[model samples]
Target: MHSIVFIGGGNMASCIIGGMIDQGFDPLTLGVSVPSEQSKERLSKAYNIAVTSNNNDAIANADIVVLAVKPQIMRNVVLALAPALPKNAVIVSVAAGITVESLQSWLGSPRAIIRAMPNTPSLVRTGATGLFANDQASQLQKATVSSIFEAVGYCCWVESEALINAVIAVSGSGPAYFFQILDIMQSVGQELGLPEREARKLASQTALGAAQMAINSDQSPSELRDQVTSPGGTTERALNTFRNEGLESIFRQAMNSALARAEEMSKDFSA
Candidate 1:
């Protein structure tokens, strides 16, 4: 088994660690480095793995290092830890807006590096992750990286770094879009003479049920939607109003705006 070390023991790191252990990865092969004794003790207690305040010591013999620290502190932290890394160790980072070029430059030498984009849903193990690896990364390293994210939820690799921005527009920011819909649904339901609590429950449960049906069924989303939109029906009226209001156009503009912002952030860190 490859020895894995995490550079931070925060929520995202904790979620990944928990997923790995649940998937039968050896606890003894895992280690974590954090800045606080409280975090160190908590991780060690929760996983029965080694935890230290010393970043370099934790990765001494590691085959893989996961950089889970905040982006603002990443460059300094990586420069400090680079000299101690095992020669063949692979580095995977979870901080958003940080690009592969920045990581390579900070390391000051050739290294196998990967950029991972995981959304808020990852905390609940229903996340969708997008991954991209530098050319120096080996197939074995890529496979190991894929297994790590898959332990939490769905994951896929993109062919180019630019597509990672598309991922940002899609799954990375996609949850908020659904959340907005749910919120409006709840508001409208309450306005239609239903009690507030019951309206909330109805909206949430329906969202969950609909998601399940879409995931479990063989039919495409548009096909399933068509099935529900009967001729001269109430559902039809609502859908017509949405179409007339240019719903699809609105979504296109919004998602592209997210993509543009993502690209802008990457540029900010590109130096």
Candidate 2:
């Protein structure tokens, strides 16, 4: 059993802990360091794991220390735990915009580090995570980290950290974009005289089914969409309108904007 420690007991950390436990990881092998006594108690009660307000103690005792704190607090947390972190312990960071080099510098060593960006869907075990590991990470360390994420959802490895900004735009913030589409569908359904609750249910299930079909089918998304859209049919009508209004271009622009923001944040944190 791997001993994992989380430096922050926030929602993402809790989701990971829940995923680990569901995957048959012993809760006792997990530990969390949270600043709030109430948060610590909540986490301990929820996961039946050890918790403390002392970050150093958590890092010293674990084989893997996950830096789950916000980017703003990450450097200070790493610096504080650097002295106590056992040699060879792997550091996994979920803090957005914080680079591997910055983390290594704050730790005062070329530590084995894996930077991951996982979105809110991680709470439901349907997350998409993009991982980038530093040179110091061993094969075993990489495999272990991959397994942890795989248990929760899909995991993809990126060769360059620069590509992670694109990952953030696509997967990190993807769920919110889907949610907005769902909201619009729900509103349209209700406006068409469908009951509110039933409209919401249908819209949500339609979204879920379409997503699952895209994942499971061998056909590309465009091909699948064409399969549904008969020429001069209702679907074609809507598609035509969307195409005429440049929906695809709009989405491309939105994702590009998001990627630019992520790069800006990375620069800000690095500075």
Candidate 3:
């Protein structure tokens, strides 16, 4: 079995590793390096995997080392682990905004590096991840990384690294957009005389059901929406209000803002 080690045991790392274990991966093959004693103990107990505060030692012999640390500290972590990292070990960075070039430069060696953007939903094993690899990364390495992220949720690759920023806007930050809508719906439902508890559940469940339908239905979301909206129906009236208020324009601006920030972060980290 190929050994895999995660360099950080934060929530993102914890969820990914938890998903891996749930997928029947041998705990003996998984390891983590986290500085927090509490995090170490929690991760070890949670996944029955090896855990330590020593980053170098944790990844010394690993075939795949996932850099799950925050982007701000990623450079320091990579520089310190560079000498001890296995020569051919594939490095997967789950941290956002950092590019493959920055990682390779920090390593001071030519390494196969992958940039992965996984959403918070991975905590529930329903996350979506976008992955990009440097030219040095092989097909086999890509497949292995895909499987690792897929364990948590849906995972896909983008040909251009630029698309990684688009992924950030679309999926990385998309959950918050949905959450905002749910919050608004719940508040309105409460104002419409529904109890708070019932309103919250109804809003959440409707979002979940709508998501499931979008995924399972052969037709597009637009088609499904049209099918549900009849002439002068309540749905059509509400939809018309949203359209008149330029909801689509608002979303475009928000997502574009997210995309810009992602690009800005990449530049910041690159320097």
Candidate 4:
């Protein structure tokens, strides 16, 4: 078994570890390095895995190192571990906007690295992750990294590292878009006379059910939507109102703005 070390024991790290453990990965091969004594204790107690405050010590035996630290501090964290990193050990970074090029520079070598864009839903083991591996990484190394993310949910590879920003806008920041829609729906339900609790439950369940249908059915979302939106019916009226208000154009502009911001972040973090 490849000994895996998590450089930061934050919620995302814990979720990945929990998913791996749930998939029956040996806890003996897993370890975490956390700065906080409380965090170290919490991870140890919760996962029954090795925990340490010394980052180097935690990674000494690791075949795969997951840099789960925030993007702003990722450079310092990478530099601190550069000396101790195993020559061939694969480094997988989950920090947003931190490119593989930046990581290689930080490490001062063409170390095998993979950049992952995973969303918040990962905490519940239903994440959609976008991965981009550096040229130094081999096929086996890519698969190894894929297994780690796949333990939680879906994994898709992009050809160019720059495409990671697109991934960030689409999947990494995608969950919030859904949540926003749900919030609006729930509020509308309340305005229409449902109790707050009932409004929330109804809106939430409808969203969930629609998503499930999209997944289960081979038909496109547009086709399914058309199926439900009969001419002169309530669904049709609501959808027509949305269309009349240029909802599609609004969504397009919003997503484009998101993509642009993600690109800006790439530049900011790379510096």
Candidate 5:
């Protein structure tokens, strides 16, 4: 019996499985069940693990079953595997906008379930995950789930399911926001007549350095910004323009809107 079974062999699942392997887990101990033969072949070859198209076969001998499928497909997948899963198996779901209650209902009862939201950055092993578990999960089960997430990146627990939406806004959607800023910086540099390659290198390195500094320094981000913004400096001029245009307010509004949308999707799935 494999210790973990991943029902989807997509990017997120691949990242997690790869992380687990890198953390000294035996590849033969993990099983992946993908719908497409091509995906099965790819996952099996890439991870040197067993692969199957049958979800039931995948979960039949697994202790932890990770539902890594798309949200729209989760219900069907859970329904198909519910009858075959071990009575005491722990189900961990990584689908966005799907609640633990909905997952339990789909699986036929309130069982041991962990609802997790992990960001795209998990591919690089810098992802942030928010986890919420149902009351049926034991202390050891929760710790195992937390360890799995932490193996790929960082993991935090949320008290309320509502806060998971905020987690979606801040951490789940954060990488896209940062990429947009990088795009803007690259475009501005090109407008200033800098070569495209040079502009990209400078912009990317600057962003990386700033992020590392923020992570390592004891100072707040605002304080760091102030430190870089000397009177009459180029940074100060840009900072002044951003402040005048209410950039902070715009970011706050954007994140709030994302949170609302996540909540709406959750309601839709539950409905």
Candidate 6:
């Protein structure tokens, strides 16, 4: 088992560490560093992994270094920890908008680096992750990276780094979009006379069921949706309302905004 060190012990790191441990990865080989004593204590208590306040202490012997810090602070953190990182270690970054070039620059040397985008559902072992690797990274390194994410959920590697921004627009911010729709559906169900708890349950279970159907079926999502939307029926009437309201256009604009913001952040963070 490769030794893994996480540079931040925030929510995303916690989710990954927790997921990895749940999948039977050796907790003894995992390490995390956080600035706050309280955060360190929580991580140690929660995962039974090594925890330290010193970033250098965490990466000294790591085979894989996971950069989990925020994009804004990643440069400072990487530069500070560069000396501690083993020369042959692979760097895996999960932060959005932080490019591999910036990481290499901060490290002050060429290193194998993998950029990954993982959503919060990883906490439940149902996440979707997107990854991209630099030329310095080997096939074995890429496979190792894929296995780490796949343990938590689904993972795919994109051919280009630009697609990482697409991933940010889709899966990275996708959960919030789903949650917003579910919240609205739940509220509407309550307004339609169901009790709050029952309405929430109904909406949640329906959402889960629909997602399961999509996953289990060979049919495209549009085909499945069409199957459910009968001619001259209630579903059709509702769909017509959505079409008239330009829901598709709204979603397109929303995702484009997310993509644009990600690109802007990348420019802002580039070294």
Please provide TM-scores, in order, for all candidate models, with all chains considered together.
Answer: 0.95, 0.97, 0.98, 0.97, 0.96, 0.96
lDDT of each: 0.91, 0.89, 0.92, 0.90, 0.90, 0.92
Off by over 4 Å in 1: none
Model 1 scores a TM of 0.95
- Model 1 per-residue lDDT tens digits across residues 228-271: 89999999999999999999999999999999999988887663
* Model 6 stretches astray by more than 4 angstroms: none
User: Between prediction 1 and prediction 6, which has the larger TM-score?
Assistant: 6
Q: How many residue pairs clash in each candidate at the backbone level?
A: 0, 0, 0, 0, 0, 0
- lDDT of residue 237 for candidate 2: 98
Give lDDT tens digits, candidate 3, residues 62-173. Answer: 9899999999999899999999988989999987788888888899989998889999999999999999998989999999899999999999999998999999999999
Mark the regions of model 4 whose C-alpha exceeds 4 Å error after superposition. none
Error of 3 at 86 (Å): 0.9
Worst 10 residues of 4 by lDDT: 262-271
Off by over 4 Å in 3: none
Residue-level lDDT tens digits of model 5 in 179-238:
999999999999999999999999999998998899899999999999988999999998
Report per-prediction Cα RMSD to one decimal: 1.5, 1.3, 1.0, 1.2, 1.3, 1.3
lDDT of model 4 at position 57: 90
lDDT (10s digit) by residue, model 6, range 53-116: 8988888888889999998899999989998889889999999889988998999999999999
Residue 139, model 6, lDDT: 92
Q: Extract clashing residue pairs from model 4.
A: none
Model 2: per-residue Cα lDDT over 180-238, one tens digit each: 99899999999999999999999999988999999999999999999999988999999
